[model samples]
Target: MTRRSASTGRWTGSSRCCPLKTRPVCRSQNPRSSNEPLAQGSPASCTAAVPGRERKSRQAGRPDVTKLLVLGAGGQVGWELVRSLQPLGEVVACDRRRADLSEPATLGALVADVKPAVVVNAAAYTAVDRAEQEFDLAQTVNGVAPGILAQAARSAGALFVHYSTDYVFDGSGHEPRKESAPVAPVNAYGRSKRAGEERVAAAGGDWLVLRTSWVYAARGQNFVRTMLRLAAERESLRVVDDQVGAPTSARLIADASAQLIRQALDERSRGSFGSELLHLCAAGETSWHGFAAAILEGWRELAGADSLKLRELAAIPTRDYPTPAARPLNSRLDCTRLEERYDLRLPDWRAGLMLVLAELARKD
Candidate 1:
């Protein structure tokens, strides 16, 4: 798979594409467009045809019928959502160019124009360190934009699906943070996201705010890809050992989201769509250092690349490699609420990591 780095803004290659859940082709927002279109690098047609599955679903008396409007259809989660949500309905995927979150005022008009039955927003100002200096821009995109989307969804009587971060917490306490835990963001990015979550709740009709942590993807720039790239280049790596959280896969997140959406659709008449916030993440936890070591170990075992130049990987504290913005020491999030509500549980972080590493090895 290929990924564009979010931190360095560089392109890197390593793994195969994530497993796709196929479905029938749907009408596109722009029929004559590529997945990576120009015009300010906006997202192109995000729909992909899977005639086999579509026919099967129809035969089963459950037709693919919903109209899904996906924002940030080019990002990690958004990209996977395009594939996973296809079986559910017609997907109109738009990238930043089509549904720019920074332009909050224009979002309402865009959502209204689409008038989709379901609106899933997977975009945000994700540059954590950069956000410290660009707080205004971050607030506009991460805070104001969600409310606009939520309002639009409410007006259209659509189910609003949003992804949030674990940064909403201040990283205090040793135990996993629950959905009812008090929020105390210690950084600009966290603050902005928390604001967005609140706004969504206030503006919501049927909505779900899914909070996740340490999100990685087989195709996107994430911790897994970063670790692999670094190991290839450097002989030694020093990673933070203090901060801990599950390194969740974007693929897993997208699949879980689709499942939750299906459940919501089926139980809407039973008042299952009441405004709710749930933590959706991989099981177990580890520090950045532990995660890196696991990635390397998985690669070595799966790829048989023990001849790599990398020799040592040292564990360091957060203070040793400080960034502009502060990070939570404890990023662990309790997924009990999500499990109870959706009747699903995520795989452990190590399991997901192994799958990604295997994909990477196969691609190489």
Candidate 2:
């Protein structure tokens, strides 16, 4: 365990491979425009700015320690961000309730007060289906908040770390979408997220947008929990099989984000630039049915004598699965950029699921 400072915002870590340095980034506050209109897509130069951070990360040198402030302390990603940012420096985790993202002035004030070395925004409008009807709220939270946050991070000389979704890309490509691929989101949720990405890039902030898919954790309400509950209650459970993607664990993403933030902050400490968009998810993929099967398998193996059977899972097509928002049939993110840059390895979906499953079972 790393020991963190109570007042100076300093931290002491015992990690040999990564004993991060800690310090405040800057003291300036980010300002906002009075228009209060919604920010839109990334332009040519901005959108295309996702050059590999790995390109600049080759020269290895110990970066100074930095203080980090994480927005959205309540969400799944935010929860883990709190754990991951420990070794880096003093971490101040906040959410909409703790601080206001809609009130740009408040956000700027918070940044100035925090004086963090980095800001990781894990907060967002993740209500995929509900986002269609709740466009305004979604846009406000996911789209507007990010731009505001990015500006704040940049103002504080903080490297903003962010998380995005696979929905940003309209499911039209055969291969997994790359960081540079053109995005044409079909739903309001996707549109809002894409808009957020664009705004971050356009604002010219030192940032990294990690677009992930099917994120789940034992603590939150996710697909795995839903399936397990349904399987036990109903005789048969219908799951979409046509839509395919990776089922990433919150733990995995948190760890990866930690590693990436260390590198990014290291660069910032040495006064170097870093990459913006990086895909961090598990390896391989699976349909909803496949995921259900794995969950059921976990249930049976570890589930108390009262768990459901394999016969309960009914494979269904995407058309039958109706929701307020449309999901991507191909959410396979081309992780080559991440793999090559971080030179990191990700376990398969099943492996991550198993870990989550075990955690869930322990609780159940």
lDDT of 2: 0.66
- Lowest lDDT 10-residue stretch of candidate 1: 11-20
**In angstroms, how far off is 237's CA in candidate 2?**
0.7
- Per-residue lDDT of candidate 2, residues 249-324 (tens digit): 7778888888888877667657776657988778898886787788888778887646774355677776765655
In model 2, the worst 10-residue window by lDDT is 11-20
For all predicted structures, in order, the TM-scores are: 0.84, 0.80
lDDT for each residue of candidate 1 in 1-364, tens digit (9 for 90 to 100): 1111211011011111110011111112121233433223233433323222332222232334557888877677887888888888778887766666766777777667665667899877676666688888878778888999999988877889988889999998889999999999998878988999999999959999999888777666566776777688778877778888888887888889999897887677455456799998899998878888888888888767673567988887777665667788899999988886777767888887887777778788
- Where model 1 places Cα greater than 4 Å from the true spot, the runs are 1-64
lDDT (Cα, 0-100) at 270 in candidate 1: 56
Model 2 pairs in collision: 21-65, 22-65, 22-66, 23-65, 23-66
